[model samples]
Target: MENGNGLKIMEKNGLSLNLKLQNGTKVDNGTHWCFRGNKELDTPPEITIRGVLGMLKDSLDPSDPRPTIPLGHGDPSYFPCFRTAEVAEKSIADALHSANFNCYAPTAGLPSARRAVAEHLSADLPYKLIADDVFITVGCTQAIEVALCALARPGANILLPRPGFPIYEARAVYSHLEIRFFDLLPEKGWDVDLNAIEALADENTVAMVIINPGNPCGNVFTYEHLEKVAETARKLGILVISDEVYDHITFGSKPFVPMGVFASIVPVLTLGSISKRWIVPGWRIGWLATNDPNGILKKTRVVDCIKGYLNISVDPTTFNQGALPHILEKTKEDFFQNIINTLEHTSEICYQKLKEIDCITCPHKAEGSMFVMVKLNLGLLEDIKDDMDFCFKLAKEESVIVLPGIVVGLKNWLRISFAIDPCSLEDALGRIKVFCQRHSKQK
Candidate 1:
């Protein structure tokens, strides 16, 4: 039978009616479904690490007997040496068995979970944080999303670090926020270029993001440098979104300084998670804490906006949130020390091996995060064209995967992850050295 709007409607016995329309029929395409037709989202300019690495994985020879070595990204859970703490495992198991937290978690997270996160982070901060100041997220990625969404506005722009993590750039693009790049001087141990940041900011600049214990570069900022960053944000009258996902993972002379320490100097939003430190990225528990002691964020309605976003977005798993208190409080200090010790040893091995490779130059030793950003000497190689070409060739020849720097806003550089087992990391670096030697121009 024909309907008033649709050309035809057919009803089958005990089945739902099927509506079929003529080719030229005009139908209501609601705003909710309109985004599906947006071609811009189908092909974003930003390339994700996973997307690039997956492409390399596909190029590997199936007949090769050697196990594929992945030096591409920063997940170390597959290696035995990087096993998560037993206390963390027990905490989650206990939570699951308790039969107390099967329901959906509150949008801002369970009160107990929020309180635990606040207290855990406050231990390192100058001022204490209350549960209300902390909002649990699905993970640090969502925390970043919420922070960017809260700050995004028409005619507003945000400052980002070049040779930095691409997630910030991806989110900025998706949110339609204008992005301005500030340089991180690789020669100066990846420190932020304050002059460039100053030049990038205008009256419309709403926020700036800083990744301490830096991603890809693995350079931890000193206390003095952090203070300067806070001062700069204050001078610009802009908020600071500090990504501290790698907190306490430092294995260097300088201690990890939380930007929250200078929250009183400037309004700050600190995004963090137990993923890196606890070795539980799959657990997906993270938080965004408003670190303003003077209530600047609250007064500016930023906090309200964050809460509003959380209200509509999906919450973290309830049982996982239930496990947080025990995981944060009971995990022994020795466990953390062991992780730092292993990373320090592996980083040293990676640095020494890369130093031997004539086609690669690591500017600074990795001190905190799992990665080291090394400049690729393409001029020294006969065949390789750029970082992407080098990575593709490396993967095909040796079944070794690495992330090209172009994905992270830098071309002709490579990001190497050394968080795997020391033996595996050594073998992987050996394969890389062999591959580079085979393709050297002098060869």
Candidate 2:
């Protein structure tokens, strides 16, 4: 018999584990349950990109007449020039109206969507990938979490790139995985210090991660360099996690090479998304692929572990998955090249403009990605304490924004995004120059 409210009370071994409610108050078994969050988890310092950007925005005065120039983050969707391709928008509309994709997607992914991602990635790889080798994620962020959690066994540690994307560090911390930092040499165009990685790894080391056409630093890895990275991971007896979100957008002397190209040497876990290339981050479609041509991931049960994690996790929207095939196939090369050309022009403008400021120095010219990491010469400034101070002051005084390098594990530097229109970039840079001069020690 059901209750008067049409509810059916269930029991598990004489205990429901669910509290009954009466008059909006929970009725307990002579004692109320105290549900609390896990207190054992380590909370990271609240210097995340979003957190810091929020603080900087809060520091701004509303009375200021100038428009806020956002160079702090990499989202370019607000800019008219960086709008996504027309075909991509049409694909989403078509998928929504088709009435065939309103149903729930499989936990792993829609089979055809998985196959399309595999085929797209396999075009650059020697060995083909089956649908089982790919798992769709809400975005690359979720893919990062899945990869980290899968590798987060007891006492297992993961190596991360320094001055890197903060999301990896955040996810690793949340997954309770030990993190070891491997420096990317800014003097060498931000190449990884392989020697440091050698000293950091042991039997417990699970994987090493690299972001190509890197975030924070806009250096693209050469084919030779990537080959060496794969070899190093092989020698260390660890798999490589390559993030190719900025794939094929190179405008440098080097080309964008996928780590899967070297899967023959070692196993690789690749995280990628259409957010960067297609310029539709809001759509939130990404994937994780196990590029284990040697079948090591399968032999070691890593693939099974990843699948298990996906079975209980959130997935990309089904309609987005339905539209993904068209987004990947129908989108022409010309659309991609146009964005590349725009980034090339904007990156050039960023590199040159930073050179004009006395206190800020960009060590390397940006090549592929949307940002450039530059050092802050605090001695040249009068009142600023560090990178954070510089950013806060710039936001308040000049109405321009930039990211503090300390937010990405480096101090006394800044991460400036050049993905805006050329005129806005120039205007923002000019304001930065003025702000620097205003605070100059000589002044």
Candidate 3:
């Protein structure tokens, strides 16, 4: 049946999942039946980088022209201390000057880029990887997209970490893949619950996704914890998709351990990018490396499926691809050391100050990523209703913007970024303290 807008009508088991202009009107028995009219596409929740920025802009006070503090967004460009590495800049400049890179590269990405990424990532591995096992992506997000597309098979489900990157869940949902979520035990320093994973898996399970140095949790996993996760995945015959975009940016007592270290034991698909390390979110260059030493992925033809999907997909810019080798090679050790040192100092400041606030509690100081996840003790405040309410009111009242935990799938919690300049971070913390005290029940 055709609707007024020319959208084809479709029905699923019993639920009516809206497609074009109209939303699912009804779901009978677990099945979706699309409306029979051509309707306009509905606006999805503000999930994209640009959409959130727009929301933040709309929430700003018109009387004030000064830029709003953007702790809500992940990009570090707002901080002068996080400026791109000089060698990264020079490498990209050189690539722009190289006339050979002006042409449209392969859809799967340039061979040299893949080779450079393979070499750069292979440093932490016990086994060497060939360039053929590497695939260059526009960013780690696309790598997750491609992986989900390739792994989609009927009746097969993928396990994802709850409060995980929604892109993984979004991509899987769009591809008609079933999603099974396992818990990250926050009490145990954000380690995966191996028992939960085992219970979630069956013969139909294909892969499990884990974000090392977790995104919202802000806790890095110990080697023993990672080993158990690998063992559990191996026992279930599922591949591991390791999201390591924040791989080395840690200030915690525990070290960041890459899941690729266990490749010999079980197949692993490691996704990483220089965006976080170099503070170049706009660069949009990332890599997906297959760490299957036993060739499990190759034997299953997963590698070919990934390449086939990439052939028809968009790729990273040619110039950025051309700059990979020099960016990897010429970036000085001092630059990385300095960035880590700064992150360490800022994390300490954020952590210590958060403790003094009566209404907010941080589970752990962010050990790795650019952000920290803190629980909002709603019981302690009279004005705050919930996480979103808290953030909305805080933005209006303080002109400070912080991500609500609901955005990351954790309700009543907030994710705050401490990646800004030290003074600004302290200032923001001061604003937060004032907000908490103002809303405190005693007042």
Best-first order by TM-score? 1, 2, 3
| Candidate 1 weakest lDDT stretch, 10 residues | 27-36
- Per-residue CA lDDT of model 2 for 1-443, tens digit only, reads 33675333456698753354333334344354455445434343346898899889999978999999999988898899999999999999999999989999999899989998998999888889988888999989999989998888889899999999999988887888899999999899999998999999999999999999899899898888888998899999999999999989789888888999999998999999999898888889999999998899989888888988998899899999999888888899999999999999999898888889989888898888898999999999999999999999999998998999999989999999999989999999999999999999974
Q: Candidate 1 on 297-364: residue-level lDDT in tens?
A: 99999999999999899999999999999999999999999999999999999999999899899999
Query: TM-score of the candidate numbered 2?
Result: 0.91
Give candidate 3's root-mean-square deviation (CA, Å). 6.5
Q: Which candidate do you rate higher for TM-score, 2 or 3?
A: 2
Could you give the C-alpha RMSD of every candidate to the true structure, in order shown? 5.9, 8.4, 6.5
Better of 2 and 3 by lDDT: 2
> Which ranges in model 3 have alpha carbons more than 4 Å from their true place?
1-43, 46-53, 65-67
Candidate 3, residue 401: Cα displacement in angstroms equals 0.9
Q: What's the CA RMSD of model 1 in angstroms?
A: 5.9
- Point out the worst 10-residue segment of candidate 3 by lDDT: 34-43
What lDDT does model 2 reach? 0.89
Of 1 and 3, the candidate ahead on TM-score is 1
